[model samples]
Target: MTDTTQPNTATDARPPAAPRRRRRGGAKTSPDARVAPPPQPGARPPRKPSPVLERLFALYPRLFGARFVPLKLGVYEDLLARHPEDFSPEELKLAMGQHARSTRYLESVAAGHPRHDLDGNAVAPVAPEHVHHAILELHRRRHPRTPADAQAGLNARLVARVARAIEASGLPHHDYAARVRSRDASANAVVDEALITLAAQAAKREALLRAFEASGRGEPEFAEMYGIPLDEVRRSLQQARAARTPAT
Candidate 1:
């Protein structure tokens, strides 16, 4: 008899496989995922400020702000001690170097301001030699196009700055010269000129003091006799006395 069972010609009885659900987060990414497009040609990427500097700014805005102040000599140690976890020694050193060498910091140093701590408290006076160097460096930065020969001759402004720095130091002329002497003959020549200027000023002040003492005149009388302002005469006398006083 012909079997009633029809040949099972129907397609496989299993239901169609479910479409793969997309990953919850999206398509799977590979290790070689595409990165952001590179910066356009000739277009520079914005530079991010050093992380260490950012941390320092957060901690001591006053010390690291636009109007920077001279930092105490041991500020590096102080920072490390206070924020051991926030900074690595090498990066901290690099940031500090950059900060110290910045034009703003040099300006603060050149202005004869006292060094300050993180708390903004004045800690000590910046050394006169440091001030002198800052002034020179600032001049060099500003006058990059100045001829080396002309620079060697030393400009009037630089000469005056040198004189002021050494005079403010309250050090003997020889001592000051010895401290700042370098192999640069031009710099030495400038220093010599400054010494001469300081010497003349010293002599004038000494003579004025002597005359005032001999005349037994009060500051006002002495100022009148010399046709100088009373404040000027007093300031000159005080400065001379301070110069004579030994540094502790």
Candidate 2:
């Protein structure tokens, strides 16, 4: 009877599991789950040239055509001398163009050619470096004192010369000299003011040195005279004394 009346064990056995939903690309489902990929490293950016640099590039051929090859070469040589580390062939080319323009302008002015004007006067352009050299020469002649004094004097003379050239060439005097005079006056005032400040500093230093010397302490008067801080002076004196003292 037990065998004949057995419960429906076939239906009780777990019904067949539902089929898994497939991905759109029919890829197999990973048992552990998938992770998003990491981002790749960014690429290095390109270096940009300056506007002045671009202008120089444009000017090179124009300058070369004007029979200023020697002048351009000299300019490159000077640039290389001044900035050996930074100077490159491209940079040299730019510098030479600038120099050529400057030299040309100077030559034109000297030869009685018209100064630069908005009007079509065919004014010759000068190189900035050449003008700088000429200005320096003038400054040296006018002021035989310090380099700073010579530079100031030269700058003044340059402005005056530019004004005169403009007038002689029938070009509008751009009041360049007047502007320079104003700037020079301001600079001279600053120099005068700085002299007073420097004198005060010098007096303070002298007084400090004198005090240190009179104290007869281990401190150095030179440090005080040179306006070094008390802590630094003390440290320097200690080191010096230690250096001079014989090792036990």
Candidate 2: misplaced stretches above 4 Å?
Answer: 1-74, 77-183, 220-248
For all predictions, the C-alpha RMSD in Å is 16.0, 21.1
lDDT, candidates in the order shown: 0.85, 0.46
Query: Per-residue lDDT for 23-133 in model 2, tens only?
Result: 798697696767755555795554464454455345444333343222322455654665566557676677545554454434543444223322223344443333333
What clash pairs does model 1 have? none
Q: List, residue by residue over 4-58, the lDDT tens digit for candidate 1.
A: 5655346545567999989898788887895778889999888788888888888
Best by TM-score: 1
Model 2 residue 34 distance off true place after TM-score fit, in angstroms: 35
**TM-score for all models, in order of appearance:** 0.69, 0.25
Candidate 1: 10-residue stretch with minimal lDDT: 4-13
